[model samples]
Target: MTAMPPSSPDEPLQPQRFFAVVPAAGVGKRMGADRPKQYLVLRGRTLIEHTLERLCGFTPIERVIVALAAEDPYREGIAILNSSRVLCCEGGAERCHTVHSALNSLAGIAADSDWVLVHDVARPCVRVEDLQRLLDRLQGHPVGGLLGVPVWDTMKRTASDDQVIGTVDRQHLWRAYTPQMFRYGVLRDALSAVLARGELVTDEAAAIEAAGLKPLLVEGAQDNIKVTRPEDLALAEFYMAQQEAGQS
Candidate 1:
């Protein structure tokens, strides 16, 4: 991991720019789609288009970097991909690798103190207000946080044999969503270290946690769902409709 220089206490803080990174390399095998799930259409636009629109529309996001597969053919046809504010890079086999690739691509452009908001391409229903809230709440925070929702359901611990081992407590538990925000340099170094150790991290927060950092959890709307299975498409569509109608 690359070491970042310590900041002087008397020095004034530098203005930090915000950037968005979308990892869209997954094939979404669980969705059982012929193409990558991001290429699937929702309403009149592709899922990737809607996701990008939301991120690009956010005023604070200076740039949006999309990590795509090397052999991806669908992105070429998307008109929005031609936007100057949006850039693309070759993705890796897993989500963490894809994110790291996007970060590396921004090496010359984004500063270490800048913030990177890592969002999922499948989650098209992320509310604009919720995104603003996240940025607003995390301002001046040393360790950046992520948008998530508290767990409401009864928790359980199960065994490999599909047997219930015991009941678990759900107090203070959260179902993490994205965009998970973190300092560009911190995230890059943490992810690189974790990957180099041959460990798996489900999200940016996990990688930061392994580096002995605790990220704040900002509660967001429950509708910010990642489209994983076939049924989730319909649910996302419904949520998007509600958002468009100004009801969500």
Candidate 2:
């Protein structure tokens, strides 16, 4: 599943425009909340609202494309989506589907070589400095990459019966995080191929790997956590407060 190169060596390099895609279609049943976990309020704002505002505040990103569920009623209250920098499209049932749909929605506007950053809507604590670092580190890269942190804890492989099968190596293992950046054409094609094969990819980097390419890992702060369970809301709130206090 090797992807064809977008450009040959003879062609002059072109400036790649940065665009963001956020998959906000999931119901997040694990949280056991009345509504989608993204709609859950944190520090007086919904999770999606904070996430979108952080991305929108990043000046390098030209546009932020948000993929919402077809019948999403919560987005209407989010005023930031009305900004010229934001665009909305109907999302699919899964994260991969939503991302692929979002990419398809950008067909006319995005060039093949332009950068598309796919971020999670639950991770509202992504830092602006880390965003800039990702772009800087991946500049002129052959295949794009994502922000991640190395696994420091002891790893274990457990069986279905909750028995420890083996102690896995923690080395060379990392926790993948967003926004996973890749070329517009490469990512779109990768996700399309995976979906066509009826394969589910946990992240854009995994899809890129399936396409026979290695995505670089840029070390980022651990504070950029994705809010999944009910307790994560408090952690995210604390992280945000810490970030703000540090700046102040």
State in Å the error of residue 92, model 2: 0.7
Task: Write the residue-wise lDDT of candidate 1 on 1-248 in tens digits.
Answer: 33344356788868879999999999999999899999999998899999999999999999999999998988878987789999999999899999999999999899888899999999999989889999989887777899999999999899999799998899999999999999898899899999999998989999999998878899999999999999998999999888889886
The RMSD (Cα, Å) of candidate 2 is: 1.8
The residue pairs found clashing in candidate 2 are none
TM-score of each: 0.95, 0.95
Off by over 4 Å in 1: 1-10
Name model 2 segments beyond 4 Å from true: 1-11
**Where does the lowest 10-residue lDDT sum fall in candidate 1?**
1-10
What C-alpha lDDT values do all the predictions have? 0.91, 0.92
The Cα error of candidate 2 at residue 62, in Å, is 0.5
